[model samples]
Target: MGNEDFKQDKLIPIAQRSFASYEEMYRIVDFLNKTLKEKYNIMFGLTKNNKDGSMVITIYEF
Candidate 1:
């Protein structure tokens, strides 16, 4: 590693949140999983929960 190769740029990290209602969340999750399953034939789903009042969703495969 050379010192010249280490260049620091101004790239600020941002936290992204999906602020969707219960119905919208369900639709998005279902559509994504179904489309992916039918098209790519990958079996998976989106799991969601509330942690500290923040909604978090994760993709998992069985």
Candidate 2:
């Protein structure tokens, strides 16, 4: 709607992650960590989703 809102949306988005197994999840996390750090110079955090037993990776910019 507005320029400020658009910029905020670009900063953070709601995403969903589902994996068939823990190994797949770990692989994805590792890949993302490497890519983000090497290309964008960003670091991310991984956390466990207690409700669904899934993993969540959050990358934020300050």
Candidate 3:
């Protein structure tokens, strides 16, 4: 992608949290994504931390 497409203001990581299991993280992120995505312009993502194997939830603003 070009520099303009990778602007810092485009995607911002606002918050993050660690969970014990994928099920727990998925539930919370799914709920937040559905409830807040349209009205708040926010998104939630889930990933596993490679180092510790913990579930990570990331809150992003777009």
Please provide TM-scores, in order, for all candidate models, with all chains considered together: 0.39, 0.44, 0.66
Model 2's number of clashes is 0
Model 1 C-alpha lDDT per residue in residues 7-61, reported as the tens digit of each score: 2122222323444436456677677766874454333233344554434455433
TM-score of model number 1: 0.39
lDDT of 3 by residue, 1-62 (tens): 87535543587899998867665667877888889877988888799988888888888887
Shift in Å, residue 52, candidate 3? 2.4
Q: Kindly report which residue pairs in candidate 3 clash with one another.
A: none
Ranking, lDDT, top scorer first: 3, 2, 1
lDDT of each: 0.45, 0.58, 0.78
- Model 3 stretches with alpha carbons more than 4 Å out: 1-9, 22-24
Show the lowest summed lDDT stretch of 10 residues, model 3.
2-11
Q: Model 3 residue 48 lDDT?
A: 91
Please rank every candidate by TM-score, starting with the best.
3, 2, 1
Write the number of the candidate with greater lDDT, choosing between 1 and 3: 3
On the 0 to 100 scale, the lDDT of residue 7 in model 1 is: 20
